[model samples]
Target: MSKILNEFLSSNLQELKDNGLYNEINVVRGANGPVIDIDGKELINLSSNNYLGLATDETLKQAAKDTIDSHGVGAGAVRTINGTLDVHVELEETLAEFKGTEAAVAFQSGFNCNMAAIQAVMNKEDAILSDELNHASIIDGCRLSRAKIIRVNHSDMDDLRQKAKEATESGQYKKVMYITDGVFSMDGDVAKLPEIVEIAKEFDLITYVDDAHGSGVMGKGAGTVKHFGLEKEVDIQMGTLSKAIGVVGGYIAGTKELADYLKVAARPFLFSTSLTPGDTKAINEAVKMLMASTELHDQLWENGDYLKKGLKSLGFNIGNSETPITPCIIGDEKTTQAFSKRLMEEGVYAKSIVFPTVPRGTGRVRNMPTAAHTKEMLDEALEIYEKVGKELNVIS
Candidate 1:
């Protein structure tokens, strides 16, 4: 053991603990459904990103079992060296169709998806204009690319346009790409992609939208780009199979040239083993299900509206969420965490998000109402929220 390493970790961890920022992960005993069992207590789960309740769906479970029985668990080798299976190809094709893209490439995770796609195309000579509030994965990906990064104000079109114009006119880079999240995870606000595309057109810039939270919840399960009918306009559309699709993996949907380029050039694809057969098959089945029906999508929106209305009527500040994600702003970090703790004790399991995940003094308990949540479950959670809110002086 290294003494320096030990001291560094200990000091940082102590700082986190002293600042009310230490995260203690809970153990979910079984499937991550609407109701989850944690340490012998079943709680109405509002923390999961299982937007459409497909994580523990019986059909997806069967699909996974069948694929595992047929193809084993691992991909056996890196994709560049025969790891690519038939199901992987099928998944890529299905994802392309689902995303309305000409071709697609699958990755091990959403984080890697951004890393691979960004670095694969953009390099040290390029400049990336990224949304300030984009996901951590995108931030890390841009860093990995070694590009001249410019941070645009969150959802500010004029800022993006001005910066883009400067970057394009300065003649300092070979390419300029604007990257943003289709729907921000923490705040639940939808990105203004149409304005982004307009800016791209004005400057001939590349466009990338990481629609991790929007895949199954927006555009009738197609995505944000499709919702705006910009399938041909946006250059790259990245999505995850874990969140709403309720499996695990990520993919980039775009033209065949881009897909082919990534297939050969992306480091993760060239160096890392591909997604497992079971996960691939499960993702394929989930995408098919999403394309086949809008039942779950509609139900998800209904639950969101119901929960938002309930929170608002109780005088809680739920932010401007265009999707099903709801955040009850609690302001102070300790109070926000205490509110979440009380909710858990009262049989609800929403998590408190504070800095540096969000801005300081804007701590919140983020609620994610899935399609699997019953009306009774939401009602019960709301009742507990009311009681806790009044007790904590968060509501009158």
Candidate 2:
């Protein structure tokens, strides 16, 4: 490697370490579940996004195995080419039905979906009104679109309405779009979708919602759009198969015309390889499970409530979360990370979120409670949390 590049890497990494922003990745010995083993120690895991716990479900595992046996390991080509298999078509169909949309299209990952979807629909002449706290993928997507992006305050309906009205009335752009997260990941808050849709209608702006964290967790697992009964009204709905779906991919659900347009216009779908057969099969089965019953969904919320109540009872600031995602706010970055480290030492695996991932000085330890966690497991985790919180002076 060049000397200049080596020096650049070393300096940047050192800077991260000095600022307490460096992440030390823990290796999981096996499948990610409610309980995970790390470096010879088994811990109660509360850091995963496996809300419904289908990641290691027997049915999904079998579906993946069967697909691999029949279709081999790879998709063979990009989606625009021969990579589009019957299983892929079936998955899209299932997604469309599950989302209550006219059609849908899948991508290699949620990030790719955002990149492709935004650029496909918007260009230099368009304007995008995006939520300030939307996912990094959405921010990157807006940047990639080359459209003028106006950031609206997080979940501030008045800000969104004002921005939407201004963007539309200015008449400087061919089209205006408002994009937001259906569920804010860090804070565990649901987006104001109903109000957003109403504003979009009043301003005649295109509406998009990234429901990555909402799918399989809200509206009996149909997601936040359906939770607010705006499935048919929102112009574009994007979701991930990786999170609650317990598989790995992302998709855009919309009208048949939008799907058709994206098929030809989305560069990532045209250029990158499609999802593997096993993943597609597992995703399809996961969606089927969500459509079949609400048992897992209910359990996930129960676990979330249990953990949240336990943390709050201990005097930890859990924040205002409306979903299963819980955050134990610690305020200071180093203290927050130290709190997480102490929890791991006490046999609970949770991670700390700080500056960049969240606003500075508002550090938090985010906990994800899944359906797979047993009552016994949660009880043990809570006990560890209590001990660690008290020891760290995060709780009395």
Candidate 3:
């Protein structure tokens, strides 16, 4: 490395470590499930995004194995090249059917889905009204679009309406788009889509919903757009197969025209290699399973409610989460990190999320209680949380 690079890294590293902002990522020894082994200790895991527990499901595993035996591993090249396999088409078809869209296009990851979709449609000549608490990927994608970005206060329809009116009336741009997450990942609050749809209609703004966290957690596992029954109104619906679907990849479900445009225009889809045949097959299987039954989704909600009630009863500041994602807010960064550490040591592996991931002085231990978590496991995790909370003086 260059000397200048070395000095820059050393100073930033020291500052983060000194202020308790540095994160130490633990290694999971095996399959990520309700229980995980880290550092030779088994802990009740509350950190994974595998909301439906399909990551280790026998059906999904068998689908992957069967595909690998026949199709081998990789997709050979980019989708724009010769990489479009039959399984790829099938997966996209499944996604569209699941999301109640006319067509869909898949990407390498959830992050790339935002990167690809936003830039493919919007340009610098346009303006974007974005939610203040939107995910980092959506923020970066908006930046990449070169659009004039307006930050709308989190879930404030009034702020969005004013921004939309200003952008559209100013005539400073050709198109004004509104982008938001279907579910705010950090806070677990669902988006106000009905009001958003009405405002978008009034302003003629192109609407985009990044439903990465909402994909399998909302709409009976279809997604947030479906949950609100706005399947025909939202312009673009983006989601991930990685989370509740418990596989790997992202997709944009929309009209046939949008899918066709993205297939030719999106840089990630044109340049990056396609998803593996096995992963595509497995994702298709998972989506089909969800569409067939809501057993897993129901269990996920039941567990979320259980954990939220348990934490709140102990005097922990579990924020106003509307989903299975429960956040135990600890104001100071150092204390939040220590609380998570104590929980891990006590055999519950919930991680601390701090600044740049969340705002300063609002550090939290985010718990994702999946369908895989048994009542027994949740009770044990709650017991551990109570012990750690009192020991740290986080609860009375």
Candidate 4:
């Protein structure tokens, strides 16, 4: 109610509007899948993270319904108190097995998991070498740890080695950790885990990989750490169930000792209520499905290849992507936003990612093709892209 606070907020919001950075959120009127309904328009959804398209799977839905009937809707207390239900423990066990880790712990969301896990392990006395293009969650986690953060150039082994050697040689901290995203969401590029593992060993640095986008996409659906066979090498592996698993939670998979330590020390784990029984059960089923079958994973790759090739054929700049995530590089923020708006208007829904989310001038419209999208649907989407691309003069 303070006039000063109102004025400050208004000024900041106005700045966003003036700069074409203020985004109006669209309401998804139907279920989220490879296609969705936004503002009464049916659009081929290429911006969702449901990589395996398990979010709307009948099996997962049934599992959630059954669990809700049996366990009710919520875990009524914080995990440390009484919220840790059997389903939660089961999911943790399943996740540990899936990730090839000794143990695992779940949190309310991937963002909170990053905040809790990073802060729990790295204190002010510790130093962290972070990848320059790591996720915002990783950046926030590093900040929360209060560590001496040294950002190595993205995917540059030389830079990482130099920083690691310098930090370790200086001996200014109790522990040194290196953190990166296993698969960058924007570019869909896999992290150089082999190089990172070697550096971590040489410097005796703790390794942390946030595989939010890599889970159920890389390593035949296990993750990037598993893709590179670094499960035993990396110290901490974090992932989100909300994306590929079609549920709402996050987890950190690591050694039993590390998981135990997080259970006691991580603020989000200790203070936040545990995931609902329905979510926990659905996630368990989703993990089981991923481990048991590769159908969805294959379909996801097919869709990704189809979409990427189609975009390329239309003369749109699809960046170097090795995973399901595809980016149509637009360079400028305003142009990127305009491009996205035009796509939506043309009945395709892909979001524009700009400054802060990504580096300035590297603005792009990121597309996430899931297993649920049919070939015909992708063809239709590509046609729309061609139409919009020409209209925007992005392509001939």
Candidate 5:
């Protein structure tokens, strides 16, 4: 490599190491379940996004296996060309129904949905009022759209209203839109969608919700929008098939017009290879299961409440999360990393998250208690947490 490139890489790498911002990847030896094997050690896994534990469901697995045998693996090409398989059409239909929308379009991944849908709708001539703490995918999608982005404070309806008024009345843009995550992953706070929709109605602004972390976790598995009964009010709803759906892909659910427009305009759907048949089939089955019952969803909440109560009682700052995603806040970055390391050593596998993912000095070890996690597993994990916390002087 050239001298400049080497210097740039060396300095950045050293800085991350010095600041406790460097992420160490752990390899899961088997299926990512409530308990996972890492480095020959059995650990109570609390770092996954599998809220309902459908990722390892035998039903989903069987669906994928069956489809792979019948349709082969890949979708063969991009959807616009020849990849619009029968399963693809079926999955989108299921997704649209799940979202309570008129139509839906699937993408290869959740990240791609934002990258495609945002730019396809908004442009430089428009302005996007986004939540200050939205996922990075939303941030990047806004930038790619070339729209004037105005940041609204986290869940602050007043701030959203003020920004909405300014953007819509400024006359500096042709159209304005408000976008936010249905659930903020880091803090696990639900967005104030009702108030946001009210504001949008007042200003005639478009509304979009990136429900990547909410689907199958909120709205009795329908999503946050449905959770609030705003399915018909919200214009665009984007969700992941991977997270709670327990598969691999994303979708944009909205009116038939929006879906039709995106089918023609979204570059990722035009260029990238489509989601494989197996994943599509599996995702379809998963959604169907959720519609059939809320057994997993109820169990997930039970585990989350148990874990949060345990941590809070132990004197850890378990933030004001309203979802199964819990964060044990340890302010200092280095200490947070050390805390997580100690937890790992004691048989729990919660990982530390620091700068960039969350604000500086608010580093945390995010714990995801899923439906697959038993009361016994949570009790064991909590016990380990208490021991680690006291040992590390994180709790009295």
Candidate 6:
């Protein structure tokens, strides 16, 4: 708009382009299932977070459509302003039951859930000990809380223990909290919850675990907190209905007092419009599915293992991943982007992660294998991977 603003944007744009950091957005034309259509080409979609492939499930779709018929569309107002629908109450109850918590409160999205819950609990007089590799939402939440942030090494229990001990012994804050992702998204590593819980017990620090990527993928789909049997120990359990739940919302599961406090004090909950009735109903159905069976979860893991083995056999570095998320480490940013482009040309759509999304020189092509993927589909994708890997010199 303004000349100065235009110049500023141009400068940054040129810098990104010169450094091979600029990214081009692609239009996904069809449903984001195990396979997706991008630019009129079908591809084995390996870039989605839909771990269980429930996003397009008939059950969830029907539930959403049925709810829409009964409750119209939007929530009309914020939760505090008479916008809380019966579906919202039902979803919250379902979430609480799923997470084995006394109460649960839902938000518009996972990012906002972190922003709301963290600030509602921690304050200026408090201190936070966080994992270095925690999700961006956790970082923003800690920052929003205005707590003295102390970053511990990623998944390093020793560092966490030391920091927790120091923060508590200093007596410089009224309260201290240790926060981490239940599963690190990029690297596909699980958090050391058992050790973290022990440290929290020792220091009496409030515990927070953001299970955005862990819900419906861990604990037979209950989440990482349940995976580690720390359901009651972890003070705050944050998760998303967007990922594995195949809906659009986030929630905080904890004690009744904590949920009550968030409902009253969290700015997003108090000011933002509540989730749609369709989303609420769909998420309730998703949770019920997970509670009833583990078919999808098992299928997802099998697909992940198959893809990882296939990639590894082709001489591509799949990185150290213990979950369904697989990353083919390509190192340089340009090479990573180029490889992703080549894969797209071959009708395999996998996104490249570089720089800001990951650390420098650690760029990768992350793959998410969902339950809906058939064995034949994965085998075909692996053949494409082999061709691309060889062409790009990523494999011999």
lDDT of each: 0.94, 0.93, 0.95, 0.92, 0.94, 0.92
Q: In candidate 4, residue 313 scores what lDDT?
A: 86
**Per-prediction TM-score, please?**
0.99, 0.99, 0.99, 0.99, 0.99, 0.99
Write the residue-wise lDDT of candidate 1 on 173-199 in tens digits. Answer: 999999999999988999998888998
The lDDT-based order of candidates, best leading, equals: 3, 1, 5, 2, 6, 4
Quote the positional error of residue 70 for candidate 4 in Å: 1.0
Q: Pick the candidate with the highest lDDT.
A: 3
Give the true-structure RMSD of model 1: 0.8
Pairs in steric clash, model 6: none
- Which residue pairs overlap in candidate 3's backbone? none
Model 3 misplacement above 4 A: none
Which of 3 and 4 is ahead in lDDT?
A: 3
Q: TM-score winner between 3 and 6, please give it.
A: 3
Looking at candidate 3, what is the lDDT of residue 35?
98
Q: Write down the RMSD of candidate 5 (Cα, Å).
A: 0.7
Q: Per-residue CA lDDT of candidate 2, range 92-127, in tens?
A: 999999999999999999999999999999999999
- Which residue runs of candidate 2 sit more than 4 Å off their true CA positions? none
What does each candidate score in C-alpha RMSD? 0.8, 0.8, 0.6, 0.9, 0.7, 0.8
lDDT of 4 by residue, 87-166 (tens): 99999999999999999998999999999999999999999999989998999999999999999998999999998889
Q: What tens-digit string does per-residue lDDT give for candidate 5 at 307-396?
A: 999899999998999998999999899999999999999999999999989999999999999999988899999899999999989999
Runs in model 6 lying further than 4 Å from the true structure: none
Off by over 4 Å in 1: none
TM-score, cand. 6 vs. native: 0.99
Of the pair 2 and 3, which is ahead by lDDT?
3
* Alpha carbon lDDT at 346, candidate 4: 87
